[model samples]
Target: MQAVILAAGKCTRFWPLNEKHKSLFRIMGRPLISFCLENLKRAGLKEVIIVQGKKRDIENELKKEKISGLKIRYVIQEKPLGTGHALKTAYSYLKEKILVLNGDDYYGAQEFKKVLSFFPSILVKEEKDPTSFGVIVPQKNYVKEIAEKSKKPPSNLVNAGCYFIPKSILKEKIKKSSRREYEITDYLRKLAKKEKLAFFKAKEWSPLSYCWNLFDIKEILIKSLKREIKGIVESNCQIKGRVFVEQGTIIKSSSHIEGPVYIGKNCQIGPNCCIKPGSVIGDNCRVGQAVEIKNTILGANNKVSHLSYLGDSIVEEGANLGAGTIIANLRFDKEKIKTVVNGKIVETKRKKFGSVFGKGVQTGINVSIMPGVLIGREAVIGPHTLVKENIKEGTAFYSHFAGFKKEKKRI
Candidate 1:
């Protein structure tokens, strides 16, 4: 069987951090996609086709890793069309059976094994919020019907976007969706009517759909981190729990790190610093003295100076957080943090969600950012200000919540 990995998504929900399709993001020196691909390789699958857009990051990474002998190839999805159109483009190359999956989600080996057994099946999982997705109505382990956004789903098995399509379906010449685009859901719905489609429940799965999803991945990585010191530790440091200190990183005396925490290569955790669980300091990062980071993800080359608290936030590459800065992850009233997406306040389902910043963002000293705020690429925040809303790309926003000045003279 062949595998068709659909990576053509624009990843709009992830916003600033995923402005580009960098699906192969590294987790502890290994690309995230690598983890998925290796699973397929170990399962003895040789042919894998990756559907991508104009961006060649995925293809380039495959070459950089010298991943050959698997008949790995790429198909260009010229337009930002639906997933159905993407699979149609790869029809000519598909043979007897094809495994369709999203590139951003991680499905365990056992799940793939089930797919290999049931060649024409859709992997689903029971979810509380099935209305947000195309849900499946199954009867006795077989899919009865699929209702897209059904107010009352017959079942809670939401489509995980992993399908085992037979070659016969490709010969049917399925038509495009109503929006003038082809979607995989339409094809599957048609197939479900014609033949009995098997369904398997997911044993382990994770979706990289939102900005906070990185926190889920971080927690997964921290659990796998080895509790050994590969790097040098200067005297006066206090390290506990399961911490993975990569070689060339330094923890100066007066620094305290509590794991499940991961420090990337060549990083510096200085004196009087405290890093808590789910904290990932990327390569060449510096956590200065008196800084505290908890449940945060700092991308490469970030510098968090002294007297800073980065909690439950995502700091992109080359970001510099000034001293005395604070990232408020929780609200004053303690409600679920909601982010404005496409003029809609979408609930993040997270009580503590800090800002999501793109690369090259800079903030002045004493800056304070509210929960669920998103700062665009290269945006700047002036010192002693509070950012309560989103900042546009490359724009500088500054506001002091001291007091509003009254207009004395009317012109």
Candidate 2:
């Protein structure tokens, strides 16, 4: 059997972090799509086809990984049409029964095997809010209908974006949806009406629909981690629980590391810092003295300077947090944190979500970022600045005794 992964969509909803393909987002130093590919390979599918956008960023990123024994092929979609268009673009390469999956989501190998056990099936999961997903209506053992984000959903079971279908399904013509793009759900709906589609309930589904979803995926990945200390831990440091320290990393004295934590290669930890559980520091990162990191993910080369407090936040690669930088993660009211996405306010569903910093974001000393704020790539925050809103890419934010100011970045 062959597998096709649809990865060509322009994930605009995942702003700030959407600088690259959404699947390229890393968890535990591995891309999310790489996990999907590994699961597919374990499910007995050796030949895989990836449908990527014209930029081919997904293909380029995967080339850095050392994946063996899988015959991987890439197909360019050329345009941002839709999932249906992406599937059609790869139709010439697909043969026999094909397992289709969404590249941005993560599924377990057992889930893939269960879906493959029932051919011509769509994997569905029970979700509390089906309005955001394609709700499935079942009849007996087959799928009765597939409704896409209907206000009054027929069932709570939603499409899990994994399908086992024949190659001939791609030949059927699908009209453009109201969103002006062809959707793959149209073909599934047609198959449901013909009573040829079956339904399989998925046991696990980790989707990256929003930025905060990264925390959820991180928690999921950390569960499988065991204690493997490959670095040098000073005598005074207190290491607890399951911690994975990579090569060339050093934990300085007096630092307290609570685990289920992952420290990537060649990193420098603190001499008097407290690294709480669920924290992941990427390669070449630095966590300086008196820093308290809790449930935060720091990407490659990030520098959390001395006396900084980063909790429940995600800092992308190459960001420099100056001394005394504080990221507030909770609201005074103790309610769910809300963030602006695509110019609209959306609930993060997390009560403790700190700011998300894009790549190369530089924060000056004594900078304080409010909860749910998203700083864009290459942005600069001047010293003593109290950021309360989202900062656009390449913008400079500063505050003085007179008032706050926003200007185009000079550096």
Candidate 3:
């Protein structure tokens, strides 16, 4: 059996998260898609086909982590088509049974094993929002109807987007979906007419559709890190609990690090900083003096200087937060925060949703970003600004209360 990893989606919903592909984002110091590839290899899969776009970042990373036995093949998703079109592009090598999945989401190994055992089947899961996903109405134990975003869904069992299809089924013509793209769900709709599509329940799943979705599994994954130290630690640094410090990371003096935390490679933790549980600092990151990072995932090369409070947010790579930059993760009313993804308001279901900054973005000193605000890619927030809403890409926003006061004096 072969696995087709669909890594070609441009991930436009994740604005300010860089133009690079989403699968290339690292988790615990490893590329996200590599985890899926590694699992496929571990499951005795030899031929793994990864469909990528023109972006070479994902392709380069795959070359860096070359496995011995797996025959890695890269196919280009030429145009911005739907998932069904992507599968059609890789049809030449898809022999026997094929396992298909999205690259950004992680489908667990055990679930993959179950799907593999029940080949030529579709996997479904019970979700809270059935309309937000492709839903499957089941009859007895088999899939009866696969509906694409039913406003009134018959059942909560959603299509998890993991399909186990035989080579014979790949020949059907997938109709163009209402979204103006070829969809695999169209074929599955046809498949349900004749064959009883075997349904398997998905135990674990997560979709990376928006910025705050990064925090969905934060606490669970941070604790699962291997508590081993490979980095240099100063004698004055206080380290406690189950902390996993990857290679090239350094803990400076008087910095208190509590466990259930993962510090990635080449990171520098401060002289007088405090890092609490559920903190995942990525590679080459810097946490400076009097700073506190709690239950946050800082992407690579992010620098949080002195007198800052960063909590419960996903800061993308190459972002810089200046001194006294306090990210307001919680609302004054203490309600769950929401964000706009693809022009739709999505309730994050998390109270703590700090600002999400894109790559190479900078925040000036004393910046206060309100809870759940999204700053776009390459955008800059001027010093002392109180950001209340989303910032568009490549723009700079500055809040000037002093200027307003000066004008009032003239009036």
Question: How would you encode candidate 1's per-residue C-alpha lDDT over 1-411 as one tens digit per residue?
Answer: 588999987887877767667476665665667777877777667899999888877887777875645788799888978888887777788877888899988777777888778757999988887767778888887888888766777778888888888767755556766667778887887899898899999867677887778777667556657788889899888899988898899898888889888888998888889898888888999888899999888888889888999999988888888898899999999999999865678888899999888898999999999999988889989999988898888998887566778887877
Clash pairs, model 1 backbone: 84-183, 84-184, 236-253, 254-272
lDDT of 2 by residue, 2-32 (tens): 9999999888878788889889987678888
TM-score of 1: 0.93
Residue 343 CA displacement from its true place in model 2, Å = 0.6
RMSD values for the candidates in order, in angstroms, are 3.9, 4.7, 3.1
lDDT of 3 at 127: 85
Candidate 2 Cα deviation (angstroms), residue 115: 0.6
Off by over 4 Å in 2: 403-411
User: What tens-digit string does per-residue lDDT give for candidate 3 at 257-364?
Assistant: 898899989988988889988888889998888899988888889999899998887788898889999988898898999887667777878877787887778899
Q: Estimate each model's TM-score.
A: 0.93, 0.96, 0.93
Q: After superposition, how far is residue 67 of candidate 3 from its true place, in Å?
A: 3.7
